[model samples]
Target: MNRPSILWKLYIAAFYVFLFAPLLVVAIFAFNASPFPSPPWKGFTLEWFIGNGSVFGKPGVLMDPIWLTTIGNSFKIALPVALLAVIIGTVNAWVLERAEFRGKTLLAMMMLWPLVIPGVVLGISILAFFSRTANGLEDVLNTDIDSLRPGLPLVILGQLSFILTIATLIIAARLRKFDRSLEEAALDLGASRTRVLRTVTLPFLQPALIGAGLVALLMSFENFNTTLMLVGSDPPLPITMYGQMREGATPAINAVSLMLMLGVGGIASIFALTSKAQQ
Candidate 1:
């Protein structure tokens, strides 16, 4: 028994090491003095974040216009996607959970179809559908439908197509566990449906809503496969980083990776605090 327990602990330890050692290396090399993100330690420096006013011919991630633009574009797409997905997902969850209608199971399955599809395939399908529609509209009415072309709008739409499903699943799972008696009791005690929902139901769903929103935000930020298909002139961080890496990127990419890890950690901390407060 003791030997089995010791082996199980070692297995868990080894699994975590396998998962996180690369991230650990990336974090450490973010501050490496060398321009490349490779070996020999190269001491430590913060130039990858701030740079030395361009005298050293290295602009760093923050100093680089392309990197900044990609980062900005990532935020622009992610914020809206998260907001829209959460709102729409909450409504879908409520409807699915509280209401029963004909073909309800089919409707639910249809709603979740996007989750099973590959991200690249989903992106391609969306692109093709929009392209056909745009071409038809142009040929018929000769209008400038540039907005429908591959860009952030399309990226957001593609992300939302699947992310909405994930958000719905998260919220709906929580909703399933929710006791309807509270709402019913509140209604019986002269509270309106709106009041019951706002005061009682929403409070109970606070954790799920936060979790859904956070998942949506991070998914949008890190998404690459779908974003790659829909991206046009402007690229997101993942796409930009992939391009830079293909062309032999500098250690500044490490800095960006560390920044992302820190950002994720900070967001997770806020989520923990919010959940605790709600409890």
Candidate 2:
């Protein structure tokens, strides 16, 4: 057995520092009483965390109506995207992995093509495609395009376009390791195709399904470039944050960042524990 060299230990320590130092700074500054997020080390305060104005004689950073609404809107888009993307992705994974058909290669390539496209390009293309389609509908139906505004619905679709591919890949990788003999035996004995899928395949794929959905949820929540193009009037948290930052950053943004980190960290911790227990 050999110990790592002193240089290697220093290198690993430096890598972790580079990775987490910024996050640590952001977390620490969330409690800063200063108006701005940067240093000169203002005294610590809980004003940003609790939103308890009575205690501080002023409202916290999280009290803005638009910020609260943006948070809600993010959840709205992310939830549906996670569900729909997972469903479509699971079916696509199953079909691609278990079935035989013409154009299969083409379909698989199409599934992965979204990953190669830049988000900005994808957003612009989707906006153009939908705008043209909406125009055509307006001409045909002789109605206003108000109902067809690229709002949350369009945001969901845009996110789903790429997120579904992520789901498919995650599930597909898990599917590759699955033992088909259980499925074959179930089919041969008494189970129908749907039954086999429901009872055997889906159960076996549960971990992948959950992991993929969580990933989709996180991606949708944090999405900016594509959501910015298609979000219309209802901005998600990322879009709102970007707009705020362009003006100037405040401790409020740091507080928001801290909250997000805590929320995601909590979820990830739970997921890790659950997976470990299952194992």
Candidate 3:
């Protein structure tokens, strides 16, 4: 038993090392003075953090127009997707958890279909369906259909289709643990359903909704496979970074990655702290 426990501890240590070592390397390389993100330790520098141009040439930070625009685009797509997904998902969870119907099982399965489907396939299907539908509409109207073209709107829609399922699952898990007596008591006190839901149920589900929103935001922000198939000329940060890498990127990419890591880590810490405090 002692030997097995020792071995398990060593295994767990090794697992964490394997998991976090690469991230540490990337975090370190983000400050590498050299142009490239590799090899012999270059003296630490903040040029990459600010922007390559900040030290040597033109003045630009990660907040420069190009990078900033991509960031904005990512947020633009993610924010709406998160909001819509959480709202729809919370409602769906309520129905699935509290209401009974003949086809409830089938409906539940269908709602979760997107979670099981490959993102690439989902993206491609969405693209094809929209393209065919738009083409048909254009043929009927004899006009340009650029307004309904694949871009930010399609990205949001594609992300929502799957992300909402995630939100639904989270909300449903929380809903299942809820005390129905509170709701029943509220109803018995002559409270309207809408009032009961707003005052009691929504508050009860707040944490789950926040968790789902955070998850959806991160998922939308980092999503590549689905966004790739559906994006137009303008790409989000992940796609942009991928392009830069293919075109010979520098430590600047590492710097952006580090910033993202820090931001996400910070957000996660806040969530953790808040959840603990509530508990």
Each model's lDDT comes to: 0.89, 0.86, 0.84
* lDDT winner, 1 or 3: 1
Ranking by TM-score: 1, 3, 2
- Where is model 3 more than 4 Å wrong at Cα? 5-12, 52-54, 57-63, 273-279
Superposed Cα deviation of residue 272, candidate 3 (Å): 3.6
Q: Candidate 3: global Cα-lDDT?
A: 0.84
Point out where model 1 deviates above 4 Å: 5-12, 53-55, 272-279
- Give the poorly placed runs of model 2, Cα more than 4 Å off: 1-8, 52-58, 145-148, 270-279
User: Which consecutive 10 residues in model 2 have the weakest lDDT in total?
Assistant: 52-61
TM-score of 2: 0.90
Q: Best by TM-score, which number?
A: 1
Backbone clashes counted, model 3: 0
After best superposition, candidate 3 residue 255: deviation in angstroms?
A: 1.0
Please give, for residues 30-118, the per-residue lDDT of candidate 1 as tens digits: 88888678999878788898895364477788888877898999999999999998899999998899898999999899998998899
Error of 3 at 177 (Å): 1.8
Per-residue alpha-carbon lDDT of model 2 for 1-279, expressed as tens digits?
388999999999999999999999989998988767778986988777666566544456578666688899999999999999889998899888988999999999999999999999998899889888889999999876753567998899999989999999988888988999999999999999999989998998888888888888889998888888898888999998998889887677788888899888876776677456435
For residue 56, give model 1's deviation from the true position in Å. 3.7
Residue 228 displacement (Å), model 3? 0.6
